[model samples]
Target: MGVGSSSQNSSAMVAIKSQEDQGSAPDLKPKKKICCACPETKKLRDECIVEHGESACEKWIEAHRKCLRAEGFNV
Candidate 1:
């Protein structure tokens, strides 16, 4: 039983290491379900666009995009 358990553990380790090497390890989610992610950036982006117009809000918009990408969102 002890030998069998060790073999299984090693197999699992090899699988994880393989995934890491391939850079295919499950890290980023397919999409974030929460609409509230990156609220601070979202707020700034929204307020800027509303007050100044979209063209003037590019900085805030890109900041929000960067924030969403950091939060595992596809944006």
Candidate 2:
């Protein structure tokens, strides 16, 4: 009975530890990218555009704005 009780307790502890580990993991939401259209972000976006090109940065900014709007944020 003692061995059986100890095994059950260890299993419960393992389950609790697993739940805590999962809760502590970082959220999976997409990170905000540099907005090329905004004056404040223009410099950073320009550098990214220079390296990655105009089309890519423009697409990123547009997508980011759309995401903000979807989230009820007034971008």
Model 2 lDDT-worst window of ten: 30-39
Across residues 1-75, which tens digit of lDDT does each residue of candidate 2 receive?
787999999999999999899897554443443242344444555577889987779865666566555444456
lDDT of 2 at 35: 44
What ranges in model 1 sit over 4 Å off? Answer: 1-26, 30-34
Best by TM-score: 1
- In terms of TM-score, how similar is model 2 to the real structure? 0.31
Candidate 1 residue pairs in backbone clash: none
Please, what are the lDDT tens digits per residue for candidate 1 over residues 1-75?
A: 687999999999999998889796458873555477888998999899999999999999999889888877777
Scored against the true structure, residue 38 in model 2 reaches a CA lDDT of 43
Candidate 2 residues lying further than 4 Å off, grouped into runs, are 26-75
